[model samples]
Target: MQWPDLFDDDNVDDDDLSEMTRKYLPDTVVWTTDWTTGSLIEQLERNVFNVDPPFQRRSAWSDTKASLYIESLLLGCPVPPVTLAELPAQGSEGNFQYVVIDGKQRLTTLKRFALDGELKLTGLKVLRDLNGRSYSEVEQEPEFRRFANLPVRTVVLRNWKKDEVLQFVFHRLNTQTTPLSTHELRRALLAGGFTDYLDRESASSEGLQRILGISEPDYRLRDAELLLRAIAFVRYSNRYKGNLKQFLDTITRSANRSWSEPFARELDEVVGSINSAISAVYDIFDKGAFQRIDDEGQPSGRFNRAVFDILVMTFQNETIRRAATADPQAVRSAFTVVNRNPDFKRFISGTTKTPEAVNGRLRIWWKQLSSALELPYESFEQVQTW
Candidate 1:
C-alpha cells in the first residue's frame, strides 16, 4: 500500500501548516508500546480491551491462518504492533473502550486462543510438539506462561476527536491489505450504537435479504450501507447541513453518545419504516425490484445502491408506509419515471457522493414518488427528524 505524500512545505500556507500541526498536537493522539500478551489477555478477559476494533477488517482468518499466527507467536517472531484509538468517554463501561485501528486479524486470533480459549495451535512451521493443542489443553505451568509472556506491543492513540480525520488515518493505515470502500470505512470510523445497529439489524433480517436478492451480508457491508443511507435521510434530509457523506457520519457520531428511551423509540420507528419500505418495493416490483442495467443493456437481477436509496426513502413516506400496496401501478410508474429521466439517472450514477448529486436524486425520487403514490409533498418541518 502506498502512503500519502508528505506535505509540500513550499506550497503549504501558514493556515494549512497550522491546521496540520494542530491535528497532531501533543496529547491529541498519545501512544505507548509497553504491553505483552499476558497483560493484554488480562485486560481482554476483563473487557477492558476490545480485540476487534472498529474500522479494522472483519475477522476473516481461517483456522489455518490463525494457527500460523499462533506458530509465529510460539516462535517469538516479531509481528507488527497493534494500533488503537481512544475516543471521548460517554460515561459507560464499553463506551470508553478503544477502537483497534490495525492488527485486528492478529489480535483477534490471539484473543481467540488466550481469552475465548478455542483457537487450537496446528500446522506449525516450527514447535511441532505444541501442535493440535488448544490454549485450555496446554499445561498452564510453562506453556501457558510462555504464551502469556509473549510480547504484544500496543500503541494507544488518545483524543482523536473527529470521525473523518480518524477515519482517513485508518483508511491509510489499513491499506496493508485490500482497501475497503468508503462505506466500510464509515463503519469503523463511526463506531457506535447506530452503525452497530444497522449491521446487526440488517444482517439478521431474512425478509430484507430476500427482497434485495442477497443470500447473505456482503463482507464489504454494502447492504448495511444501503440501509443506513435510507435511515440517515429519514432522520436528517430536510435539515441536512453539509456533505451527504459527512451528514451520514454525523448521525453515526451522535449514535455513539448514549442510548435513552427516546433513542430506542426513534430507532424502532425508523427501522419499522425501512422494513415497510422494503415490503412496498417488493409489493410493487417483486423480487427484481433492485435489479440494475448491465453493460449489455440487459437488466441484471442485482441490487443497486442508487435504486435502493430512492425506493427505501419512498417507503419512509408515512403515507406510503401506512399502505405500501395501495397503488402498485403508481409504484411501478415511479420506478419507470426514475429510470427514464436522463437527469435523474445521471445524478444517481455520476458523482453519486457529492451533496448535489445525492440531494438531487432524492428530490427527484420524492417528486416522482409523491406524484405517483398520490401523497402530498413532505414539508421541510416533517423531514428534519433525523
Candidate 2:
C-alpha cells in the first residue's frame, strides 16, 4: 500500500503552543556590581571567569563593531550590564568562579583588544584619532586610561537549580540584541549530558565531519544540530508531528533532564548505528554524500539535511548497509534516480520540515533503494513513521 502524502504548512499546533507558554520560576539569587575594565581583564587573565561556556555562542562581533564598543567605553557611554552565572565552588578546586551568560562578545572584544593585541581600533566615529592604533600603542594615552578605568555593571546569578531557567533568561536577554540561531538557543537551554554527548560525538566523528564538509567545528553549532536531527528521526520518528523545531527542542530537553543508564546505553547504540550508516553512505557516495545531485547526475551544492536524515536512518538497517556495501554502483544509481524524481526533489527541498514531506521522502528513498538492492521493501515499511 502506498503511504498517503499529507501536505501541511508550518503552523504551530496546540501542543507546541502549550510548550512555548509553559513557565517556571527558578530559585536563583541575583546581585549587581560595578567592575572596572581593568579589574575584569585581571579576572579574565587569572582564569576566574569562563567566557566560553558551553551555552554561550562564539564571539560574533565584527572588528568595526568591537572597535565601536571600545570607543563607547572610552567615551563613558552607558553600556548594558554583563550577566554572569556563578559556578558552585567545589572544595576550593574549581577553575572558574563564574560563567558569562551574556556579554560574551563584549568580553571577548576586550580580551582581543587588551590582552591578545589583535584588534586595531578601526571605523571609530567618535575616536577617529585612535584608528589604526593597537591597545599597546595607546595604553599610555588618556583615552586608553579612561577606557581601562570605566565602570561596567555586572549582574550575577547564583544558586540556580534548574538549567531551564538560565536558558529562559538567556533567551529573554538576547531577544533585543542580535537574534540567536535555534541550535545556539538549544545549546544554551539544553546543555546537559545528552548535549555534551552530542558535542563529543559530533567533534570526534571524522566520517560525519567529512559528510558535513567542515574541517573546523561550526561555531554556530549547525553540525551538532544536523546530528540531532538524524538522532531524533532515527529514534523518535513516530513521535514527530509537523513542527521540526519543537520536536527537536522537546526531545533535547527531555533527553537531557531524564538521562539514565538505560538511556545512555540506548544513545551508545544509536551513535553506533549512526556511525555505521554514515560509513555505508560514505562508501557509496564519498564526500558527495548527503548533497543533492544536479541535472548532470553529479552531486553538488551544500549538504542537504533532509537527505541526511532519511539516508542515515535507512542505512541503519544492517541488511541495507551490507547490500549497499556489496553493490556501491547500484546504490549510487538508485540515489541519482530518486533525486531526479520530481516528487522526491520537492520532498527534500521546499517546506521539508513538514511531516508529509519527511515521511514521503523517506518512503520513496527506502522503496527505491530496497528494490535496487534486491531487498524486501517490507523491512522499511515495518519501520515507524509519522
Candidate 3:
C-alpha cells in the first residue's frame, strides 16, 4: 500500500503538479494485440518484476487453451488485446508494475502455449477470411497447417503511472465480462514457491476435486480462483488476505522444504487434507448447530462458520511447521486425533474461545494427533490462530 511521492521530480512538475487530474476516457482504457511479438513472455517476465502484484493467481489455463491461442496467432487470428493498468509504486518490486487489468486468462493461455507447446485445440482454426468465409473453399489447404505455427497478436499499454493502474485494475477486475475474484487474484500474485510447487504437482482441477470429494465439477467448481483459494488456505493455512500471492512466495520460500513434494504425491495429501477438513466442517461444526432438516435431508439452518476457522488454523499451523512428514502412519494418526476432537464448535465461533484460546486447543489437538498418528509433526508445536 505504499504511495508514490507526488512531489518527486519524476512524478510532478513545478508548474502543473497542482493541476487537477482529469480523464477523457472514463479513467480506464483497454487495447488489443496479436501474440506475434513474443509479448506474452515479456509481459509474464514483467509480471515477475511485479512481485507485489502477485495478488493475481498462478497460471490456470489448460494445455488446450494454450494450444488454441498458439493456433490462433499462427493463423493470423484477430485475438482480443491484453489489458494493463498503471498503479502507483508500492516498492522497488513495483516501480513500474502494471496490473494485467484484464485479459489475464488470454495472456496466461498464450504463455503456456509458448512454454509447454502441448495444447490440444478443438477442430477450429483461425483462417476465416473476409466476407465471413472460412478456408472451406480450399480443399486440403496446406496454408492452414502453416498458419498454425505462428504466434498471436499482442496489444499492451506501455509504461503507465500507478493511479491509472489501480483505477484500471479496479474496473476490469470488478466488471462482469469475466470477473477475477479476490481468491483468483491471490492465485495469480501469491502463487510461487510452495504454492507454485503445489500447483505444478496437481495442476488439474478435476484431479484435485476428485481427491477432495467436494462435488462434481460444475460452474461453481469450475472457477480456478475458488480452487486456488481452497488449496492455498489449506496448504499454507492463512487467511485469504489481499496480496496473498506475494506473501506466500516470501513465506513459502523460507518455509521448510520437507513440507513440499512432487506434484502427484503432494496433490494426493492436499486432497485428503481438504476433504477431511471439509467433511469435519460440515458434520461436526455446521450440522451440529441445527435441529431443522430440509425435505432433501440437508440441514436447513446449520451454521458451519466455526469449523472453517478451525480448519484454517489447523492447516495454517501445518504450513508454518511443515508438519507433514515422510512417514505415512504419522500423517494418518495426526489427522485421526483431529477427527476425534470435540470442541471445534466452541472453538471457532468464539463461544468459549479467543484467538489465544484457539491456539491452545490446536496445540493440544496437534500433539495428541501427531502422537496417535505417529506423524513427524509431533516435534513441531502449533502457532496462534488467525
Candidate 4:
C-alpha cells in the first residue's frame, strides 16, 4: 500500500538552500558605535528616535519589567547595549531618524519613566531610597540628577540600510539574550495572516491538548514549536536545510508575503490533515497515548518532544493512516515495538534536530508499523524485528 505524499521532501541540499537564504541577507554599510547619554532625552523628543517602529513586535514590558531596567540604571549596573540603525532621509517621507533595532523593551522602559514620567518606579532592590518615585519627582531630589545623566550605550549602524537588514538584525539581537520565545520571534519577523492563522489554530486546538494531555500552552511556546515542526516537515521535509529554527522562520516569513484566498485554502488543507490525524490517534489510543513509560509501561507526567515527533510522523504516513482506520490497537502495538527496539529508544533520545535523525526515526517507526499491520509497500525498509 503506497500513497504519494503532497510533496517529496527527502532531500534538502546546501545548493538549494544557499540561493533561497541569500535573498534575505542585506548589504552592510560602515557602522559607527557610540556610548552616549548626552541629550538622550532631547533625541527622544526631537522625532529623531523612533521606539515603536513598523514591523517590530509590540513592546511587551509590564511596569515590573520596566522597573528592573530602571533599577539597574539607578543602581549603576551596566545593562545590555541598545542597537540602533540610522535610516537615510526620505525626501517626502520625513527626516533621517534612528530606529531601535534592538532593545525596544529597555528603550520603551525609558520612555515610560525617564521621559514621560508616567510610571512611578517600584520594587527597586538596590535603589530602595528612590522606591515608589517617578522620574519627574525624583529629578528634584539632590542626588537624582546622577541617575538621569547615566549614559546608555547605543550601537548605531549607519546606512546598513535595508528593511531586510533591519528585520534580520532585529531577529538576531533579540534572539541572543533573554531570547524571544518561538512564537514571539515569529510574530515579530513574520507578522501577517498566516502566523495569525497558526496562532488561532494552535490556541483553539483541543486535539493538540488531548494528544499531548497538556492543560495549557507552554509559556516558551514549546507546544507551538512542535506543532510547527509537524507542519513543516510534513510539507517541506526535503526543503529543510541545516538549521531547523531558520527553517521555521522561513515558513512564516514566506507566508507573510504570499497571503491570499488560495493561501488560506492551502493552510486549511494542512490544518485538516493535522487535526484529522490527532482525532484518529485519540480514537485509537482510548486515553490519549504517549505518556506511558518505556519498558515499565507506566504513565508519566512530563511530555516528551521526541515521542510526539514519532507519532506525528506515523500519522503522516499513508500506510499507518489506512491501517489505523481498521484497528488503532495495532498502531498502539507498533508503538510498543518502538519502545522495545533498543536502537529506536536511543534514536528518539538523541539529537532529533538533524535531518538524518528526523528521517531515520520516522523510517524506523514506519517499519515497525508496517510489519505490525502487515501492509506491503514498495521500498519499505527491511526491518530487523524486535
Residues 1-386, model 3: lDDT tens digits: 11121101111121221221233233344455455435455656556323223332444455445556545655556666555544456786656555554566666554444333333344344533311223232224564444544455434454443232333343444554433333333333334554454444334444334322334332212234334444554555443333333333344444324445565476566555554444433333333321222344343343232233344445444442243333434544444444345554234333322344445455655676556545555344433322
lDDT of 2 by residue, 1-386 (tens): 11011112211222333333354333588899999999989988776676655633445677999999999998988898999888777566665477677887888888889888989999999778889999888787788778888999999988777554555566678666654444665675457899887876776677666754557565556567767878899889988988776788889988999988888888888888888898888888877787778789897655677888888988887767887899999988998999999988898876687789989999889888888988899977755442
| lDDT by residue (tens digit), candidate 4, 146-238 | 556677777876755334455556556654355444454455445688777776676567877664455654433434655677677667667
Ranking according to lDDT, highest score first: 2, 1, 4, 3
- Where is model 1 more than 4 Å wrong at Cα? 1-35, 46-48, 52-59, 86-97, 122-131, 139-153, 180-200, 207-226, 253-258, 291-297, 300-302, 318-337, 369-386
Q: How many backbone clashes does candidate 1 have?
A: 3
**Residue 360 local lDDT, model 1:** 80
Please report the TM-score between candidate 1 and the true structure. Answer: 0.71
Model 3 off-target regions past 4 Å? 1-75, 85-101, 111-115, 120-122, 125-174, 190-276, 282-297, 300-307, 310-386
| Candidate 4: count of backbone clashes, pairs at least 3 residues apart or interchain | 1
- Global fold similarity of model 3 (TM-score): 0.40
Give per-candidate clash totals.
3, 0, 37, 1
Task: Compute the lDDT of residue 209 as modeled in candidate 4.
Answer: 63
Expressed as tens digits, the lDDT of each residue in 151-179 for candidate 1 is 87888878765555555555666556555
What are the per-model C-alpha RMSD values against the true structure?
7.3, 7.6, 13.4, 8.6
Error of 2 at 311 (Å): 0.9
> How big is the positional error of residue 367 in model 2, measured in Å on the Cα after superposition?
0.7
Best by lDDT: 2
Best by TM-score: 1
Judged by whole-model lDDT over C-alpha atoms, candidate 3 comes out at 0.42
Error of 4 at 7 (Å): 29
